[model samples]
Target: MGIKLLSIKNKFVAKCLLLTSTLALSGCDDWVVMSPFGDIAKQEAFLINASTVLMLVIVVPVLLMTVWFAWKYRASNKDATYEPGWHHSATLETVIWTTPLIIILVLSGLTYVATHRLDPYLPISRISEDKPLPDNVDTLVIEVVALDWKWLFIYPEYNIATVNEIAAPIDRPIQFKITSGSVMNSFYIPALAGQIYAMSGMETKMHAVINEKGVFDGFSANYSGHGFSQMHFKFHGVNDEGFDSWVSKVRSLDNQTLNHQGYLKLEEKTTGHPVTYFSTVGDNLYHDILNRCVDANTVCMDKQMHLDKHRAKNAVKHKE
Candidate 1:
């Protein structure tokens, strides 16, 4: 019997070692979302864990009580109380109602706090719990254009652009002004922040900051087309000096300009496209995309809306 027990222990240890070795070889990509590198993602993870624990507080007790009641009132247990006329217990009713109510109240409060605090539109107030952002810290704005299964990141301040890649300085706040060139898509970087939608003729905002330096994955969470599976990019979180160096490198490699005509060529469907850099972007390129008026003869949506409103007002006046 002792020999059998020793053999079982050895097999368990071998299986544990094998699992550990496999994980070590493959890296931690699977758990990267839960193990966040940014403040917003950390808070989101915390909220998820807290909510799960709060729910389990109710779930575990109910499950245990179910088993306990079944065992205690079993037909074979002769000592069990069996009052046929017994209908209800006030204490049981109160417990069944009150515990869940308390849990719900607590969960509601937690949800309220987490929802507003973690809103992607709201700018981050700090780098982390211990680091507060100063009033004078300028924000880095990266305009994101979701093209046909690819991402275009334009640095308006620096007059540089890159396709299928993005970067931000660590501990510095970053805001993304997102739009799509054609179909709707979702921009998601799991380690940095939550996902936000992007669609043509509309713009969305996402605010986040990377607190650690590493290369993380970014992808379109929404399905766009045949190339959707391959629509992914690399996000590099770097220090201030490294970020500047990266910008300089990107500027040096630029061989093309991303203007209206250039953007039109990019609208074509392709898969597994290589990362490309652009030296310049047209001044009104993003604005045109947002208004669905990139072509020269097309009327901007805002202007068309204004005309429609004016015509409606005139019609109402004539009727009166």
Candidate 2:
């Protein structure tokens, strides 16, 4: 009777899980991470899948053993062993310890390789698995700034900038130099690459290429503040000609220029921000922001650090 009740409870739990998974799958449009459009994301997805499978090898067996032990050692089971002196078995000890140790080693190796391979700071050299990044195509450099509830992208090559929307040519390598103007945030575009943290007065870098021509979601994955949820941007992967046209359109936005003063105004906290284009961005605007001297009255972090070092040296000389 006890065994029967346990079986019935297990069946109900299994049925509930199946139903939940079915419902979740029903609302899916695309498996953005699992089926990503870029080489970096695709490789990341592979690592994820491999890691999941490795975990399940240990998980499935442990789950099965748990149920087996529960049933085999049940109170009502007359066939169950009841030896008072039996505490440990060499075979059981070896199996339990060896299995997890092997899994850990395998997982550690996978993590080491994946960490270096998918490192955000490491520059990627290929577009896809077989296609190498061409020598003719110059790597597109996009300076990214995480604002209160929006994103700012500055294209130095074209002297153009945009807020909440960005474009790049498909199959061309793109490098991102990311920072935050307000608080710490994460730059994430699932179809392009993994999340890389963006922080104030510091810069992080990422390299990726988009193989498909489509608009993808880009956002801050970090819980920054009250307006964090509104920090979503559109990433456009277009053909070379389309990208040129998009740049031209941004350059055509009259009376839309992003300088130190304009950036200060744009950094204000807001929600549901619309896509904005800037005709021109001031030179070295991103570098100035990185050094933490966007405001005229503020001292740059670099200069401050240098001053501190000089003072320390003078103090040591005086002591001598």
Give the number of the best model, judged by TM-score: 2
lDDT of 1 by residue, 1-320 (tens): 99999999999999999999998868755687679999999989888898899999999988999999999999999999989999999999999899999989999999999989888898888989889998898899999999887998999988888899898999999999999987999999999998999998899999999999999999999999888999999999999999999898887855778898888788788888899888788888888888888888999998999999999999999999
Root-mean-square deviation of each candidate, in angstroms? 4.6, 2.8
Q: Assess candidate 2 and give its TM-score to the true structure.
A: 0.89
Q: List model 2 lDDT by residue over 98-143, tens digit each.
A: 9889988998999999898888888887889999877788889999
**For every model shown, what is its TM-score relative to the native structure?**
0.87, 0.89
Candidate 2 stretches greater than 4 Å from native: 1-15, 72-85, 318-320
For model 1, give the RMSD to the true fold. Answer: 4.6
Q: Ten-residue segment with the worst summed lDDT in candidate 2?
A: 26-35
Off by over 4 Å in 1: 1-29, 75-79, 313-320
